[model samples]
Target: MISRGIQSNKVNGTFYPTSFILVGIPGLEGAYKWVGAIVCLCYVLALLGNMILVTVISASSGLHKPMFIFLSMLASNDALLSTSIAPQMLLVFWFQKRYIHFESCILQMFFLYSFTSFESGLLFGMSFDRYFAICQPLRYGSIMTNTIIVKLVIFLLLRAVTLFSPCIIFIRRFPAFRSNIVNHSYCEHMTIVKLAAADIRISSALGVAEAFMILGVDLLFILVSYCAIFHAVFSLPSKDARLKTFNTCIPHMCVFLSFHGLAFFTCLSHRYGGKRIPPFVHIILADTYLLVPPMLNPIIYGVKTKLIREKVWKALHKCQSPHVK
Candidate 1:
């Protein structure tokens, strides 16, 4: 019974909404303030942790290796990804400001997906760095030089931008919307696409294709890289040498598991959990997936890597010394 392109807001032949309403978590309206506080705490932690990692890496010339460079990139991306979602989410939760401008929603959707793609690409590149360092030590220098790293990063940025640009265009082209009420906290792609009264098969299909292309392919390559790395480690003649080589890979492997494990769980729950799981639970899981990784990655790296641990302690000591004065 809904009219197409005939709402109070219309432009040309399309139903152009000025804003969209975001219902933070259905069935949990009473706890909005509590949830807002928790989300704010998590955002602060993620931002501080990631920025510390970036600063440490940049200030220490000793950490200028290819692996550290990739870690810096990952940290920067995590900070960005979390920043893109948390402020808007807090606004909805805290101030009863549930409405987001249409242009802002599109921009949020673009950044949310683009940073995710960048993370996958950076992780894949880190795996390659590991493969070369462990499996081909002598040529690692020649293969992963500064020039090569810059080129790889440039490629990752371009790939993410190219792949997600169409999403913005497609969202703008919808002729009408069933409603402007988005069910989740942020302007997630599928949620936005579902609002269209017109067919969304193309958008849905592109989303699937993009997910497989980025996550599936990158995951496959990482697994292959680790397999070869493990094989090389096991074949080493001495236990000490093998142990040393394997230790270097442990942090990267842990990070890879954390990011991908949460991602797959979120994806599967949405796709198959139908009536078994509550909607609020799914939204919490999605939010956790974005927040937890940023907070955890730097902790994992700082603790596991001896040099980084030393640098962090030194920095802490220096700060305390200034306070004592």
Candidate 2:
């Protein structure tokens, strides 16, 4: 089976490998079925939740504003991010179908990194929307117009493709690959790049640079936006008004904290936690960064945002109601 699956690239009368194996969640082989089941459930829930968010936002005319637009885009990003990894992960866990074509792996890595960067960009855009709404209310309408929102979305997609494409190029050109066995559930950039047989200094450097450049900038923007927002809210004379304004930001703050917080710890544990922590712990943390945010975003918004909550409740009620004769 392994010999049959080995793909070859023809160049100068020589054949080279064009496939790789994904070692999904090493250790705990006994619990593969259970883990697969849980991963499947999370993937299904993420899809359903994000789909609901997108449908409600698109169908409801009242939700055509900047915030909901960004939310819908975010939901789309979450869905894409989860889809790129989850099904393959499930296959690996349940069927032991770990051999992935080299080209396919590269494509997966591209989408994964692109969606993550785009999500971060969307968060920054949402923060900007909130900043203008709360901190500069008088100019909010003028500055945060539909045109600006559209432009921001366009800019985000373009930036994601442009920034992450180079990582793919770098990986493709790398001279040697030490092993085909990838020690993670998904085709992550660093994980795949780390398998090269040659000095992968350039690829490693690029990965770190992309992380700090994109994620760092987004984090700084979110912080500055929220700081300015809090300042403006606190200065308001009416206590009720201050509370009312602050409530709008709670859901975004929750999402930002959960997503970035998981991401930070995952990176830390992978880099420095060393052999002190079990390999399973690292796998779980890495998967959490990909899975948790997608699953949690809709819940956060549905519970906190009045319009979305009402829309969802109404939809659920409609589904539950018996058909008229």
Candidate 3:
């Protein structure tokens, strides 16, 4: 019988731990060094790429529209999300330093979830921006102003913190932990919950609810926005014109698919893939899902967007010029 948080006779009345050990990538002992190096490279690229995107969006006068602003926001969020997990995972992999303080674990989990929620909010905002730009081009400027962007940023922050704070509080109430072994690469709400020796149904429910409330709602809106956009695109007279309009959405669509697809898989696997799958697979998937999107998003946008590509080319040329050397 699975002890649903019931304290066993093996321990005292109540127990609290100072730290938890992350048992990262269980079977890949010697190979973890190589894996760690690869993950570190991905982290570096994600940071560099996102930073470039943000800098370009900020400095380039042509890219100063609402769509680009939201793109920069997404890039910033991606950088943060990658930072929350990748560095620690590398530390664990390269040095075998897997033990993390309880408070630190809580902080990592908090920011990871919060950043993910905030990303969803930004994606929703971007979808709206795209919808207006393509579906109602005439009113796009009037509808999505700097004031609106500011209000959306505030809402994203509030929504993430408000929805996830109670989860941390509930986690704090767990009377004891049965184990100090976290089975994944990084700290997450469900991963921590499994270690508890108290009933965690409420926490579990809240975690699921949080995902549905944020990601689900954002997905719905994105789909609806795209539906309207597609309807409008199909009605356009020329194939060239339709393709030109859709070209703008291509990068965002790629990002949306990768981010949401990986996120949903991780969420489902965490909740349901308990006994059926090996722990190593789960760890690999979780780590991959988180790192891939951040690394991929900027590259996708750089390749797809003409203005950004031109800016990048000019910057590269400037750097390579003989006078600068």
Error of 3 at 179 (Å): 0.5
**Candidate 1: C-alpha lDDT:** 0.85
RMSD of 1: 3.3
TM-score (all chains, Cα) for each model? 0.90, 0.91, 0.93
> Which runs in model 3 stand beyond 4 Å of their true positions?
1-10
lDDT of 3 by residue, 168-203 (tens): 999888878878778888997898998888998898
Better of 2 and 3 by lDDT: 3
Q: Provide the lDDT at 70 for model 1.
A: 93
Model 2, position 231: C-alpha lDDT score: 89
Count of backbone clashes, every candidate in sequence: 0, 0, 0
lDDT comparison, 1 vs 2, better candidate: 1
Clashing pairs in 1: none
Model 2 spans > 4 angstroms off: 1-16, 245-247, 265-277, 322-325
Summarize candidate 2's per-residue lDDT along 159-184 as a digit string, tens digits.
Answer: 88888778899889876665677888
Name the Cα RMSD for model 3.
Answer: 3.8
lDDT (CA) for every model shown? 0.85, 0.83, 0.85
